[model samples]
Target: MSQPDSVTFADIEVAAKRLAGIAHHTPVITSRTINQHTGSQVFFKCKNFQRTGSFKFRGAYNALAQLRLEQQQTGAIAYSSGNHAQAVALAGQLLNIPTTIVMPEDAPTVKQAATRGYGAEVILYNRSETNREELAQTLAQQRNLTIIPPYDHPHIIAAQGTAAKELIKEVGELDLLLVCCGGGGLLSGSAIASQTLSPKCKVIGVEPERADDATRSFHSKILYSVNNPDTIADGARTPSLGKITFPLVLDYVDNMVTVSEEAIIRTMFFLWQRLKIVVEPTGVLAAAALLEGVVKAPQAKIGVVISGGNVDLKGLGHKIMNYEL
Candidate 1:
């Protein structure tokens, strides 16, 4: 197990305090139907209802809120497919810090519009032709802007851990906790929180099967990566875990699993109908794992983190119309 002494429960507490009154203490909901189907006491931590419609707001706000005056004046740059872009943009707006985001040209139109709506200047690039990180770094240097990385930063990870902290505080200890894995920020962060608050809980990270880099890395205990996987879950389309997140995930997370694209879409639609919540495909990955029996723990207490709900309705309608599941 590789441990970097990275994020800790104490850090999450600090972030929670920082985010208090500013960030919504998102609610946790339960489903009797889901509980009956899984035969477990299921708790759904709904980050979808958070500001910017995702949990990314916690990290983005925490990181930006703690910036030095100079950094705030110079502003910051971030590169994200969707959620992080909107998060940073909104956070920057709240903190009066200018933000520039490098996003894929094909990123969800809703996300792109939200980022711009938050007042950040968005630079779109072809994912096949350009590396967003390098572009952000170059822009950062040229503009004297800070690079607020989407994940892998200690502040970001600690900030993200606050979601699981809130969940555990609300629901008490759990037997199993399932988290959606993107670049491993939320996964690793949630595991860290579960470790301290619910020592007996087993934390598992779930991803889309088409973008299973984290799963591969977890099983082999070796860093693995993908190159712009074509999964409908845009958030999980990250190439791989980061230097910070990879080690944190290897050390803290108990297991990793991946669900099919069909499972993801099916779960999203199911949640919309059953829970009456609009969960994006990426947001429902952890729920899919539990609902579809990809990772089962019969009769045990379970917690599933719904990461976000920023769906492109038009695109999702097309996907739903075409999907058999």
Candidate 2:
């Protein structure tokens, strides 16, 4: 099937309307310590507090909500590492649709359990030995399930934009907006919204240094792929940007940068210790960039997206205890 045209700002607006009362308009947080550290006034769109503890719920719910009656009755299928799996599962449960998620065997146990708890069937595969998308597609065909892609679909992209839409709406204009990039859904979607809502704000995409496909793609002007990256930021281990998201990122995003795994870990600890908020490593990507001085604009009003908080506490504790600096 042909991909839909790039998601437009108008599409995001419609998605915001559709998601109203369903997705949480998560709070925007600020920290004097963060402001002092970065020398910039910063606002954090804390989607960690969102239902399912991630912004993925916005896209998942919007996509599931728009499904036709026949599709809804038949059910939906998706592939994810963790966050999207839980998001799809919970959205399906809320909408009374059966959901099946294909995830890596190494995905966080807490996330897997949460997905199953939401009444979705779980299929696990070895990340190195199997292709998740192919498996999900085969299952979707066999089960007559509509594929609710994590980030590649226009509806998903539009839905993901609602986070930025809500942020800009609540915080007013910003000089810059930083988003964590996985498959580019959130980054591309937020870029679109930022362009429309806060046109003067430069939208930047941040990624783990190990999983820098989006950053490479942004600068190289060509799509880049990676084998699974060995990074603690599991959500950003995507191979590459999708065709739908690539162009959107190229057109609307102002810049892309990467931060070290150490920086990600440090920022996660900082947010937990200073702000009293739990942010997973992936959720701290944008903040990592700013705090590490990978991307800086002193004295400017900046917005950063804290993407999720569905961390495996035990695993996080182990990392924290073992990690140095």
Candidate 3:
């Protein structure tokens, strides 16, 4: 069985301290409309407003800030679909560490542009032709750069846990904590915090139906793999949970669920229309589970993390305009 030796609440506390001035203490919001609709007192921890427009900033800054002086001088490299790329790029720029990001050629143009705008060199590769991680490792060896993975690292998970810590602290306790899962960094990290802080709270991870490998793995207690899922929730398209995250998830998470693509798109539009916030498809997975009645918890005090606001408006414009939500 995998364990959370890689992360702990204390580690999250340290990470929170490291991110105090650097990362945004994003708002914990509530909606009477949503509460009325779902019959639950929902408290949303809006990471959409976080620096770099996602919770990835916390992990990125924490890991980069802790890099050895030698590693910092030599710089860092990373592979990300989108959010993590911008995060590392911006964090590297802030920390005066040079960064290089390997991104999919079909990644959101907005994300690609933001990554480059942060002063990181961007390298695009065809997903079908090349393995991103291998390319990143090769490049890292060539450049003597540290690899800052999207997930699968201790610092990353611990830092990601800070969001849950913040939510629990501000909101007191939760009956349920719904988190979106990708590589399981946020899900496992949040579950660890929830289990420790609000022991009674049921921590559930949500994924797109098209990319339900994590949910499948959770049920079977075996690692499962998916190759480049074609879901709108791009962040949740990771092949499978990471080595560290898989065990942490198995240990901490209470349940796992999947939401249909219609549910995902509908819930995202609902947030935008009702909450007046821009959340990407991946960001709405957890909310989709809750709002679409996939994980019904009537009258429960639900804590939901609205993960990111980085919508690829340029590329997904048509889909957004005509999404009959």
**Model 1: lDDT to the true structure:** 0.94
How would you encode candidate 1's per-residue C-alpha lDDT over 126-186 as one tens digit per residue?
A: 9999999999999999999999999889889999999899999999999999999999999
After superposing candidate 1 on the true structure, give the runs of residues whose Cα lies further than 4 Å from its correct spot: 1-5
- lDDT scores for all predictions? 0.94, 0.93, 0.93
Error of 3 at 75 (Å): 0.8
Which of 1 and 2 is ahead in lDDT? 1
Candidate 2 residue pairs that clash: none
Query: Least lDDT summed over 10 consecutive residues: which range in candidate 3?
Result: 316-325
RMSD of 3: 1.4
Q: Taking the tens digit of each residue's C-alpha lDDT, what string does model 3 give over 93-183?
A: 9999999999999999899999999999999999989899999999999999999999899999999999999999999999999999999
| TM-score-better candidate, 1 vs 2 | 1
lDDT, candidate 2, at 132 = 89
Clashes of each: 0, 0, 0
Compute the lDDT of residue 267 as modeled in candidate 1: 93
Give the poorly placed runs of model 2, Cα more than 4 Å off: 1-4, 319-322
